[model samples]
Every structure is written in C-alpha cells, then in structure tokens.
Target: MPVTKLYIDKEVEDYSNVREFSSRIDLEGEIVDDQQVIFDIIQESSDPIQKAKEVIFLTRNKGAFIKKCPGTSIYTCCGYKILHIGTFCDMDCSYCILQTYFHPPIMQYFVNHIDMMTELDRIFEEKAIHRVGTGEFTDSLIWEKWTDIASKLVTKFSKQNNSILELKSKTVNIKKLENLNHNGKTILAWSMNTPHVIKEEEKDTTPLKARLRAAQKVESWGYKLAFHFDPMVFYDNCHEEYKDVVRQIFKNVSPENVAYISIGSFRFMPDLKQIIQKRFKESTLVYGEFIHGLDNKMRYFKPLRLKMYQAIVSEIKLLAPDVLVYFCMEDDEIWEKTFGFVPDKDEGLSKMLDKRVAKLCGLNKGLLI
Candidate 1:
C-alpha cells in the first residue's frame, strides 16, 4: 500500500482526537516528501476539519464526517442529493470544475467513518427515499486505489432500505466491489464521454471500453448500474462519436441492467476558460459557441444546447428507451424541448428519478412515486 502522508494543520494538533489520529498515522518526526508541498491554511483555521473539508490537500482531514451537499436550486433539475464526501479527484480532466472548486487542490479523505454512519442513520430514518452520492464532489471510486471507501460504503448502505448510494467514477476499480453483500441499494455509476473527448480532455481516466467492461462486471455481480454523459463536448463529428459510444454501451451492458442515464452539454464558469488556457493550452472545449447563462456562467447557446441534448437523448433512447433518462441542471424549457415533458408535470424531478431508481433496483415496495 502506498501510504498517504498527512500534514496535520498546526492549530488542530492540540485536539485530543486529532492528536490521536496523527499518532496512528505516525505524523510526528516523519520526513516530508520532496514532491509534496505543505499547505498552511489549516494552521489559520479555528475548526481545522471544517476548513480542511473545504480545502483539498494531500493530507487526511481526521475531522467530523459527512456534509450537506452545496448544490444550488438548479440541482433539483438533475435529482439533487446530499454529497457526504468533499472534493477529491485523482484523474486530471482539463475541464474539471474541481480545479477551481477546491482551494489548493489535493486529495483528502475524511477517516471518521463512525460519525458518518451515525449521520446517515438519522437521515435514513426519515424514510424520505433520499438519493445520495459521493461522486458529486469527487470521483467516487478514485480513492479506492488507496482506501476501500467504496466497499465500506456499499456494505454500510446495504443495510439501509430508505436511501440509495450512487458510486460514480471513470475508473475501472470494481475489484473493491466484488463479492460485497450489496442489497441493490447502491448504483455503481460510470461517467462517460466521447472517445475524442476522453482522448483530448480527460487525463489518467480509464478508457471508455474498460469502463463499460467494468460496468458489465458490476451488473454480473447483481448490482444496478448507472451511466452519465455529462459535459458532452461538441466538436466536429461529435454526433457520430457519441453515437458510437452509445452503441458500445448497449453492446456491453443491457439497458435493462442500467438503472439510469444522464446527459448534459458542456458548460463552464467564465473563470475556468482562463484556467484552462493557462494549464491546458491544447483544450478546444473552451472555444465552443458559448453564452453567459442565467447563472452568469458560460454555456452552449440555448439552441445549440437543446440540439445537442436532443441528439444525445435520441441516441440513448434508441438504445434503451425504458432506461431512466434525465438532464443535469437543465431548466423546464430545455427539458420539454429535449424529452418532451416537464419535470413539474410529474412529481418533482428528484422523486421521479428516485422512483425509477427504486423500481430498477427492486426496492419500490411502498416507495412513493
């Protein structure tokens, strides 16, 4: 195992629990890696864990576990749910929001599992059919190379009947998930992009074929699977590329085995354009026909967005019409234009998605539609 060298913020070192955790990790009198940089923001924080939670560092934040999702109201359009985990990613996607979303971007894991389970138990007791994911802020399975967090979560969530956990990632790290006692309460999701996008924009991610193969392995393991084609970047021959990807997915995994599929066009905050230019000069995704959205972020022109969504949805529908398909952070106009139905007409989008998820996983017993 490659040990993660954690740097305890000076201010947090005085806490008994923090001290104990540091001792367990052998933090004292250890030589720092020449490649690692020491971050001092934690030293200035009164509650180091809370501050550490917001900042991504190479250290483990041994603090309070679990957190509320910081999603905007628009998150409801895409089945918003609480993300107990914070920002941490190993793959380097050029257009990833985490580059700017987290200060001092580094991979940090919160090791306080007991408190997290307690909080989840309370949330699950509400019996509200909540949909929660660890992938929202981070690639859910990226940490598996270092920690068996997904296995722990899968085993823990297997016992809960009221909530479902979605582990979304672009890696083929399903080894940690094999032979787990999953009760169909967890969705092992994969975030996919066109082969061109994967080659150009995403770095250190598993190949699309490998990801689909892994999804098939999970399906064979009796686990529900999900797929997302988020940030569907538009380029020359994008339609053909995306269509090929859909075909590949259907060929590898049956639609019946897929619990849900989500599609979204490329959208980015204006500031990210400069960051991409500075860090990833070769990326052309920033050069698309973009306009400032209502949220003052740059997105595809409304018509282009609608066209891309329509095309991708049509392709997915052709392969798996019955699979639960939805958009991420889109509005009523876009929804109607693409799917021909407003989320409002049905119960809220979240409930509709949750119900579909329940039915797919055989958990819809008395589940509210």
Candidate 2:
C-alpha cells in the first residue's frame, strides 16, 4: 500500500526536508506533538501492520545516527556500521522481523539530515575501513521517489577515501545513481532468494529476474556489487534451488566485481512464530526442524543448516572461487565443517570484510591495498 497519510513531528515541522517532501506528497500532512495519537489510530485497524505502511511519520532523530550492528555475542559479527536512516519498510514480507520488532511497528523517516551528515563526517575523517549501510532499518532505495538522500549520500562518499557506503535494497530505483560521481566509494547490494521463496513468502517486492537485471545495470555503471542469500528457507530440493541462485548471480555479474556474498539459514525469535502464524496463515516456514540456539532464537538443527551451507558454498566456490563467501550468523563448527577453516579470533570476520573493502573500494586502511 502507498503512503496515504503523512504525519510531521512538531519539532521537525520547520526543517527544509519537511517542506520539500510535503510538497512532493499529494496528501496534506498533519503536524502533531505526540506520536501516541498516530499509534492509537493504527491500533483501531484490523491490520495495524498494513496500516502502518500506509502512513509515514517524519521526525527528528534525537539520538546518534551512526551505530554498530547489534550482533549477538555467540555469533560472528561482520563489524558493519549502520547509518540509521529510517525505521520499518513499505514492503510486506511474511517472515520479516520488523513485524514484531518495534512497538506498534510504525514507518518513520528521519528528516534531520544535518545531524546525520555531521556523524558521517566524523566517520570519514577517521583513518579506518568502515562499511556503512542504510538498509539495516529499512529499504535503502524506498525513499528515492520522494527525497534525494541517496544522491546526496553517494556524492558525499565519493569525495572521501576512508569508507565505503553500501546501498542495499530490493527496489530497482537506480535511475538516480547512474550519473553520480561515486568514485568507487559506493557499493550496490541486493538481498537475493529463490523464485519459490520470493513468490510465496515475500510480497510487494521486485521479482528475482528484475532485481538481477537492475544489478546488471549497476555493474555496467562500474560499481562493486554484493549479494546476500539470507534467511534461506529449508524445504524439499532447497539445496538445488539455492545452488541455482548462486549460478544466476555469477551469470549476471562477474565474480571479480563482487565484493562479498553472505549465506545465512532461516532463524527466528520465538515471539515471531506466533506473529507468522497469525498474519501468514498459509506459511509453512515455521514447520521446519528447529532448536533453541545460543542466542535464544529458534534455528534449524545444526546438521540441517550444515547440509544447506555445504551445498551452497560448494557451488559458489566452483563458479567463483576467489569471491568472498561467508556465513551471516553461523558458529565455528559450521565454518570449520563447510570451509575447512575458521576466521582468526582476534580480527575475525570483520577484518576479512575490511580487507575486501580496501582492495575493492581503494581505501587506504593499510590492510590489503
């Protein structure tokens, strides 16, 4: 559903972004002091999650905009920094954790660009290899129609040499990025899944072929690419299906241009089980073999996850041996069994990614390049 209602926070009512977005939106925005009023309105709907997507709350980000990924202690972290651009997405995925992550699950876009840029300036000044992304909280390209934030960010990152900005999304809004002077400082990424999974579980998303076509377009523009096969569902012939996805990825873009590819099996918090049952009544994703993991979430049994990972990793290595392939949240056992080695404990996965960034993005971090 498109955004039909707009709510502007009283504190950010006078910001320039508010005026620009308000003019672009055909609907009249209602300026409000308390956000509870919007929450109460959404609570009365039969489907509040769907209702939340229909309205946007533009507010100031009173806190820090840059934050570290909240990786669990038991899992290997990628040491990525999150540029908290917004909260919640417009698309509806049956297995989306955001459905139960936020209270009442409202869609919010922060209008405080001054504060956001100030934080990014600090990151650019530091002599470090930083992988920053805006897709952690929401789809990175969903705001392209109403705002020029993506263009602004890509331009700013182009002028720097210490960090790379990654824009990950399921949308094909690359028209604005084509003419930018990114200077190898921006990476375009996608969250890829099988056609069966996309059609059944993911809704209101670009099709698999369309997303790949967009990736090809971005590659032609000379940008480094990344693909993530996350939440890989377990089902009959799932191994073959995932291998096919790996095949399609290399078929579209060269392995030499790929910065990294990550694989993670389907895992969910216990609270999300009920939400999936209540909202997606026909979904069988929760029926797979599950066990309580170290982080207290329900994950596929280790053997099952290992089987899938081995098949997928073997296919990727066969096709693109030099491309970096890593697991998202798997443990040492999975790494040792699948790849015959584990990352060093001190630098671990983060160091591996930093080296890739320096080599591919040409950052002078004193690591690889």
Best by TM-score: 2
lDDT of 2 at 175: 93
By lDDT, the best candidate is 2
Clashes of 1: 0
Candidate 2 residue spans exceeding 4 A from truth: 367-369
User: Per-residue error at 200 for model 2, in Å?
Assistant: 0.5
lDDT scores of the candidates, listed in order: 0.73, 0.90
In terms of lDDT, the poorest run of 10 residues in model 2 is 360-369
Report the lDDT tens digits of candidate 2 across residue range 157-180. Answer: 999888999999988989999988
Give the local distance difference test score of model 2: 0.90
Q: Rate residue 79 of model 1 by lDDT.
A: 47
- Model 1 Cα RMSD, 1 decimal: 5.4
- Predicted structure 1: lDDT: 0.73
